[model samples]
Target: MSPSLTLENIWVAGERAPRLGPLSLTLPAGQRILLAGPNGAGKSTLLAVLSGDLEGSGGTLTWPPSSAWAQRRAVLTQRNTLDHPFTAEEVVCLAGVSGATARAVLEELGAGAWAQTPYTRLSGGLARLVHLARVLAHLDQLDPTAAWGFFDEPLAHLDWRYAGAALRALSRRAAAGYGVVVAAHELNLAVPWAEHVVLLCAGRLEAEGAVGAVLTPDRLAEHWGISGHVDRRDEGAVLILEGFTEAG
Candidate 1:
């Protein structure tokens, strides 16, 4: 089947070097792709380009033509910069088709208790969950054919409980045929859910393939300068970072 989204040698212009990419990847429905890398790996930049907030200076990006770009894709960025004093429910309602759906999504994400709280007043993790609810609401309101959700560092502020809840929700959405892409750092919990993994290093795509194939000890060392063993558990794999190695 043809991909829902495609990037061909895509990259953003930089003052001294390319900001991101030369990445060529395709996203099909019901797939979860993990964008894994340390700081300055250009994960956020790539998400911006894919979500149509930023333009790439080179190459091509193609998406489904049936819906508006913003309607077809929902983005939950790292920072919650909405200065408006809207309540979490109101934010989701704006993204969702109706108030009831907004409330339902909040409840589903275990954020119902804070649905009336002002987004700015909530704790970092609570705020992130609310934003995620908004993203889910937006996509849920869209035509169910194929929608994409891009999350940048979603688990950064979330504790394990919230993180697990969010991951489970994303997994359910993927199972229901939505494309879920996350730029994440909490790998042990996420690796099992990811069908594909893209490793980035210094704004370059180091590896892109099935998670089991690409998420290896050798690749981790090469890209992250970490020497560790990958202990595969029944559910997921744990990356034990033993020490730092020189970047090859």
Candidate 2:
């Protein structure tokens, strides 16, 4: 299904070209999506295509089209920069689509205290929070009729507080009618909140859709080359990795 924003038949090559799928993706307005994949599986590449930074080999990526890139979409790549001297407030201001939105986002991120601090002085997690605020502020500023946003490893370097804050921010973005897509290596942090989950392996889109149906241990183990067990625990399920070394 072509999303209000979507990708069809996308092919790409980076340091290495992965054979991701003859993949079909869709992004309806106001959906919360989580993308999980092993290293080099083209997760970042897919995000680049979504944010218009990179082009795909085949298929179509379509959006409802809005005022501009800033108004329509925001991307927080895994390689986000923390090299600037800007204070936290300044950093937040950069991401806002509007002034009021920027202020509001800083409030949400509790970033006002660090507003005057240089970017270089902040911790890695704090830097990521600043970037997240930017995305949020911009989205809030525009409130585009049809908007989209992507977060690539927004949880990097985050402790529990920032992790919760960062994810809550992403959820707020999605709640406000933006198509929100987030990428992470840990399924545990993402599975409960994601409306849709996309799992990719070896450059191929292994599975994508409702978390309940798409994240079975059989499929996960097959794609990840590990052993694991998944069972109903409470409202969600529990994943126990067996002899498998890493947790997906």
Candidate 3:
């Protein structure tokens, strides 16, 4: 069966060099994937590829033929710019989700009350939430059943409420068999929710698989420059990264 996302012979490049490879991978419907990596590992670049924000340097990145989410794939980046300062409501409206749907999405993100508030005047956290709501509204408008969600540091500057709402929505999408992929530095928020984990280091795939299976102590220490233990506790694993240094 064809997956929702396919990266065939993928190669990405940065200012310094090209990340050359004929990499092949697939992310199926109903799968929530965590793109994990140390700094400069190209996590953001990969997310860009999936969302069609940037063209890949080499190889082919294909979307599912049946559930083509070219427009449904919602991506939330850390840096969101508005050419003209808009109100919270205005931002949501741009995504083609106005009226009750927009109101509800903003309410979930705890920004409903700020409907008329100038988006430029909001705090960083609040602004991020508004942007998130906008993305959700877009997905709801385009094709909910065929939507794919991609977030690159969407949690950046987001408060607890927005974070919770964002993750909850992603989970909801996953349950509905949408391909949800997140590239984030915040491990705790992602680890529990992700069905699969892909670890990248220096532009290479260090590991990829189930969350627990891919995040090992050796890999963490080697790639992240931190020592940690992966302990299976109940249903999840805890990683004590760089804790030894703190004690010392």
Candidate with best TM-score: 1
Q: Write the per-residue lDDT of candidate 2 for residues 134-209, one digit (tens) a residue.
A: 7767666655456677889888777767677677878877776777889987666677667778887777787777
Clashing pairs in 2: 19-203, 20-203, 20-204, 89-115, 96-138, 97-138
Better of 1 and 2 by TM-score: 1
Please, what is the whole-model Cα lDDT of each candidate in the order they appear? 0.80, 0.72, 0.74
Residue pairs with colliding backbones in model 1 are none
Per-residue CA lDDT of model 1 for 169-239, tens digit only, reads 88877777777889998876677668778888878888887776777888777766788766667866556
Give the range of the ten consecutive residues with the poorest summed lDDT in model 3: 239-248
Better of 1 and 2 by lDDT: 1
**TM-score-sorted candidate list, best first:** 1, 3, 2
Per-model TM values vs. the true structure:
0.90, 0.85, 0.87
Model 3 pairs whose backbones collide: 9-22
Candidate 2 regions off by >4 Å? 1-3, 13-20, 64-67, 96-103, 110-112, 224-248
